[model samples]
Target chain A: MTTVTQEAGAPFGAAPPPADGAGESAIVTEGLTKRFRGGQVAVNALDLAVPRGSVFGFLGPNGSGKTTTIRMLLGLVTPTAGTHSVLGLPATQALPRVGALVEGPAFYPYLSGTANLLRFDAADPTAPRTTARRRVAEALERVGLSAAAGKRYRNYSLGMRQRLAIAAALLGPRELLILDEPTNGLDPQGTREVRALVKEIAADGTTVFVSSHLLAEVEQMCTHAAIMRTGTLVAQGTIASLSGGLATRVRIETPDTADAARVLGTFGLADVRSEAGQVTAELGGHAPERINAALVEEGVAVRGLAVLRPSLEDVFVGLTGEGFDVDG
Target chain B: MSTVDTSTSPGAGSGVRAGEARRTPGLVPVAETLETTERHARPETPTPPVPSARERWAFWRLLGSELGLTFRRPRNLAMLAVIACVPVIIGVTLRIVGGQGGMGGIIADVAGNSLMLTFFALSFLVLLMMPVAVTVVAGDSVAGEAGAGTLRYLLAAPAGRTRLLLVKYLNAAIYAYAVTAVVALSALLTGLVLFPAGPVTLLSGTTITMAEGLLRILIAVGYVGAGMAALAAIGLALSTFTEVSIGAIAGTIVLVIVCQVLRAIPELDSITPYLLPTWFTNFDAVLRAPVDFGALREGLVAFGAYIALFGSIAWARFSGKDITS
Candidate 1:
């Protein structure tokens, strides 16, 4: 279902339907590019498809164009090149159905939390005024900010601000909610709160496309992920697929290491390394059961076997060619 | 690397499998593939139609709220207090200090006619208080949102760029008119109580009845208000260009001062009338017995030109800007 287009460098027009079809995708971008006036390439030829109802993690380092892409998706920034659609509608036409918080939540500091949400919620012309009061209160309650609803936003701590931002996005039941670095600048407790909130949001069957540079953030919250580096998408897929593809090792323990190596060789498993009576191979298409079954059939004493697949961090670092811990 | 409790989390919980080794390593772990209804993902609700009338009503409602917030701010209230004090100062000074001495301007020259004191207050109101009021409200209209990080929400609200800009302009215009009204009404009240109500001498050295004088005062108030509206538009444009509200306000004030200085240059007399501040004082023409519609018309035309020019620039800049801040 990967629809990485060839004309990604071209300007935005009508993008083709996602390979999985439009109804199944929450968001689709083709040839999405942006070149700032100072010759800086903020986003370069990005093609991203987010499936409906999944918590899609947009992973990248700082300055990797995560926020820029979110802006383009929300129609907040006009893309210098390419097009993106949300829920089968052009991004502009799709705005009403989408709820977005970019970078972080920006609200009137002079206004109280509920007041800020009220103003923002009112800006959506589709929201009926009669129900806004209850919706605003419920939103604050869900984010655990109901107690602080009367407090001015300026007085809110970083966590409160982040929660309130999420509440703003949840003022209604949106089909898609785009949050850019939702937990950014929050304390650990705040991060956990926001993470739980995101998890809870996804439970309601809403497609949440959240962006974060922290691998752990995505690892803890995403069902599917895409990694970007220096404004270019490097890898994307279900968490298992992305983790399964790179830097993974399979460890097999047996007394006859040489015979085990010969057997693996016979099985056409290249790059089998033997040490300390154990044979290791890069985990890929080869099934571990087949290895065990062959070793037993060949009369090699198989003591134990294990799959030491690469950690998600290792795959991230390998894909981006930079230390994954870099906060950006 | 993550140790999240799967029961509490939503998407990222499925991990390490048992030793059975039946599932492919590249498959979707234990995480739910999400909802089963992807085929009907698009809701059938027709796209929300943004009716123009609803939009227009929303614009005004937002403007009202914005203005309400401004009126409640200590800084803005203090500015209005100061503007409201001008007529008081003019009335008290003319009553105590000017006694029977004839001052130069139309109202100050009479000194005792309450109708004329309204005219005297505009001398100070038009130059300092009016522009400051406009600057305080308009210069922060767009920039303040960026500074507070609220512009992203407003734009992302899909408050169309042009519509949001229009709303902001109208918000500042409300403040401009409100400030002008505060000054004019205070002056009118001061004129009535602190001095005698009678026929007032016009700038052209002709006497007009008290009713005619009040009518001219109303027109003069509108004239000053129109002038402030022009400055508000300039402030809005400047606000759109910067994230610092202080910078936008200071920039607009500086531009006005520079324009005034430029207009005062004797060698630039040909261009003096074209300057923004030149039209502000044109309300004096309203005090003339034969009312020089020439300068008043010129002043309004200049105001319209300033609003159109600067307002469009704001819309263009704000619409195209990336909300990184």
Candidate 2:
């Protein structure tokens, strides 16, 4: 499936076969590593497989090698060791079909938004020049920047610059879109719009590999995610699968904490603890309703109760052992 | 051009609408057309059946866009404007000081014939001002993009590393020629309007017709342009080393100034032939009655050697560089 002949006939401009055995994953990296000068390991031996048509969020903290890895994938930086492929082809060969926005939006300050896009479009050897104008217009429109298209990039607000960067990635019909911190400077409403845009792009059958330190962004928009700490990948899987690994916690608020703890202990829950006026335990396959019913029958006087399923934030914190910016 | 042929083909001709339709379920039409386009426009070598004109146009398209960016930059335009004004200022100053007691060398010759001003200005400016202009453009070619963080996007646009390097070099070369032409034209116009126009006295004491004098000026323009192009190559090589454009620009200027300082030292005359600055004034060969082709050719060869050496250095450094910027 990794044979050259299969990829050679397609070139980069051609659409990658969506359901073929060779194209099942939009991106696959094996032991991809990058060690900078002075012996700084920015990215350790990491393996990543991003399924096609899935919105995969690459979650990591600042200085966690997310941008460095993206640079390597785009051939902007040479890897220290290992190999990677995009759309089942070598990164350079597959780059024409891949649109990327690394770090942030950058353009000639004197050039208008439209002009900057035109210059970028000209850079891609595969993009047809005949329809370049229309594609640039459509891209700007998609990102809701058509009104500001004629404005100089220097005059754009941070959010507009972020949107323009996304628009640049959308300039062509791409098989894979790699956006690092896509919503970094965007406001809340702008963030929501970008999230919707990602979902829209994913729905159109394009694989999206987005990197961000915002835990809520990944939890809300990503189907699958990989978490990185320092220079190593800590965890990776579908969002549900990752969250599923953590136990569901049961918290009950009552004046009779000791009685509630005894009651919860009777249900065979794990780590039952009573402190102050609160009793908490790992639900561990126990139904919330049944526990609530048993507590009432036992006259534990349950005032408030919450069966909390751990969010992706908790999963990330637990895996990396460091707090993340859960709000963006 | 095959743009007319292939673009008008039944499937590929429908341009914008087909592209717009691709967003929907009509991906097959766009995909089929793109495959056909790629089949014809294969990288490096177009298939044998593809029209040569289209291939040539594709080669120039990227270069054209690059040239547009370079020329449209206000900073570059301002530099060129300053270069143009240098000849005007020199010509006007020579005109006001016509036959003054201290007037000597090229200034006396310029006061006698209008066309001599063009030659004198080329000799005067090529030393530092012209090289500075070319260096600013060439040095900033890659590093400017790096500084502004646009180089990453350009490369990821998959502008092949080698091709981008070639385009940057060409862009700088074109600007170099433009700088030379601007100084020559501005000086020629300033000279003609201010001084008496007549047969030019050559360095060999032979008089040449106005048409021949203009031709000599054209030759000097080209020679100086070549010399500046060589300097541009050095600037480009330095550009590949750093993300700070000013560093590359200043480094190239400093190298040129150092060479000039070395050339001025009579004790170091043995190393004069190897220095780039020593050959820049070789355009003075045009001032002789029968142009000194031997000297001009030697200068050109030196320029070519400089270009080759620095160009390869730029390619090797840039192709393997980690574009962290």
Candidate no. 1 TM-score: 0.82
DockQ of 2: 0.23
lDDT of residue A224 for candidate 1: 96
* Model 1: CA > 4 A from native: A1-21, A247-307, B1-56, B100-110
lDDT of 1 by residue, A113-144 (tens): 98898888656544546677998999999999
Which candidate number would show the highest DockQ if scored against the true structure?
2
| Per-residue lDDT over B40-116 for candidate 1, one digit per residue giving the tens place of the 0 to 100 score | 24343334322112232455556555666677777888898888998888788778766756555544564758877
Taken in order, the candidates have interface RMSDs of 12.0, 8.1
Error of 2 at A202 (Å): 1.0
Go through the candidates in order and give each one's DockQ: 0.17, 0.23
Off by over 4 Å in 2: A1-12, A19-23, A325-328, B1-58, B99-105
